[model samples]
Target: MEGLHHDTIVDGEEDDSPAKKQDSPVEEELVGDVRIEDFSEKQINHSLAPEERVNLYEQMVRIRRFEERSLRSYQQGHIGGFLHLYIGQEAVAVGAVSVMGEDDHVITAYRDHGHALAVGMDMDECMAELYGKKTGCSKGKGGSMHFFAPDKNFWGGHGIVGGQTPLGLGIAYALKFNKKAGSCLCFMGDGATNQGPFYESLNLASLWNLPVVYVIENNGYSMGTAEARHSAGEPLARRGDMFDIDWSVSHGHDMYEVRHTINDALERAHNESRPSVLEIVTYRYRGHSVADPDQTYRSKEEIEEYKKSKDPINLYKEKLIAEGHLTEGSALEIDRLAKEEAEASAEFAQASPLPEPTELMDDIYWETDNPASKTSQGTMFFETP
Candidate 1:
């Protein structure tokens, strides 16, 4: 927070005095970052009541704690095989989903524990999934990489990189075909943005004017590979332009900014009936998965920079306290509560049962002679066949 500088490059073509951002009711530009300024507590008018603010604060903390615990469990070997922690991306889910009605849909990549919690999945259930429990959200059939909540209409924690993009658009297609009012927020990573499906999906989504929010959580790295190393001149935000979709970016480290960014994206997708892009530029403190040694690509100084200065949780607390919306003692209490809740969930998850051998066939889509139901997420509706 202290060492960062913000010297804006003037757009020489536009006679730009540091290229100003477009005006909006829900977004603004904060200090030290060129991304969209969030309508933080200070910027918000008498819009949200005190109770609503309290609930929002609690949900963000819960997501933060749930992810922290997931990381710890991953380290301890309780959670196995390619666990991706949503350490820095909590606000993108919490704030986005908070503004969505019950019917809105959310789908994202493997870094999805935060989304599951934000969308009302039980902490016990989430941790149980991490522990591969039979009573888990995905019934222990799909481990950390795949979780489906039909009740929440939270489509997935898809394993294949960039694979979920089209599925989300398909969901939007279904919503439109039925002439129903709904939206799908398809979340992907910077790495997955490189895949073919990501672009193809965007083209179709934009052409059909599908109600989908294609969000790129550009954490600046694909696994240990830096963005500069993996990505071309292709700014992930501009990916939407190929398909003529609306594009925007925000400070991914701040929930306030993330919330505002998604709010705007969803608004466009809702009112305009077209796709949109929001590139949330943030950083992660842990390794790509639980297995890597986390020593090679990035330096200690980089992690320290993000954690000490740009940590999302700290940013939220500082802005709230400074605005007099959250007291110092209240912030401390919230942290205490987050720890207690996380511990309780961990214990409960530990006590949860693992999948029984007999339970294997329970959720299989193709139990009998239906060859069409091969994939877990496949549909068997009538087609041109």
Candidate 2:
């Protein structure tokens, strides 16, 4: 909370000069500070029934608990490669997904377990993916960062930064071309915003007026570099203004605020066939990946402060309890159930068989996996002659 600056660094139109040329309007709000009291009962998660709100709370708990389990697994050397834990940003994924319609889809960066769970992905499959077991969602091909459930309209946990941005644009294009009433929620971290592909995706999204909401989960530090140090422009969502795309920012810790802002963007996408940039200010408790030591860049105090004051799970849980939708006992029960589910998932991952070595080339190509569905001819891949 100390280093979080929601105000845009650049204000109004930039001074017209050869060296000082600036793009887009710069007016921005102090975001990531929206409190639970900011919204009235009628305005906050109003559409959701009491039971549904409790479910949202449960979902957040599940994500947090799952991440905690995964972190422990990573520490125990059960997980390999990169394990990007989504410990602090549960509300953003869960709240956004809660407001989505059936046709709506989701795609996000490598820190995707939360999104996966939010979209109804089972914990066993997710944990198995991390464990590189055959039962993984990707059949053990994609560790930690490559979970995919096309049936659920969840694309993937892409390892490359900003690589999923253009793919999200394609999803939007298809939805529009097919005359489907849906939008794609393309999520990325603050670090991904600096990538070239993201800007390209934004350009086309604005140009074609695709129904895609580019959700930037700005969690202060991009990897180890503080956001202020890594990015030049303040309030990264304002970049949307250059392309004439509607953009807004909000606190990611508050589920109601997350739902409100994301629903607004989704409405723009669905109704006007337009794209929007919704930067949900969030924070991560872990490093960019499990391998990186987070202490080098960010102080322990800052992380602790966020955990104590702005934890999404705790805030939502408290809100639900205050509203009489959830009692302390119910909250504890929900958390206990989440912990049990997480532990069971870990056990499932451990007991699950590792993928056989012979399956290396399997699922690599569509034609290879599904001969009946293969319409294209010719050698898709080359074998040693």
Q: For model 1, how many clashes?
A: 2
TM-score of each: 0.86, 0.90
Q: How many residue pairs clash (N, CA or C atoms closer than 3 angstroms) in each of the candidate models, in the order given?
A: 2, 0
lDDT top scorer: 2
The sequence of per-residue lDDT tens digits that candidate 1 reaches over residues 1-385 is: 2212111111112122121123443545544433434566423323666666666677878888887887788778788888787776666677777777655799998888878888888888888888989778888878788887879989989988999999999988988888767789888888998999988998999888899988888877789887778877545676676677777655666666566667667667677777887776676777788677667887777678677766777777777777678888998898789889898888888888777776765655454346565444545443322
Cα lDDT listed for each candidate: 0.73, 0.84
- For each of the candidates, the C-alpha root-mean-square deviation to the true structure, in angstroms, is 5.7, 5.3
Displacement of residue 241 (Cα, Å) in model 1 is 1.1
CA shift at 112, candidate 2, in angstroms? 0.3
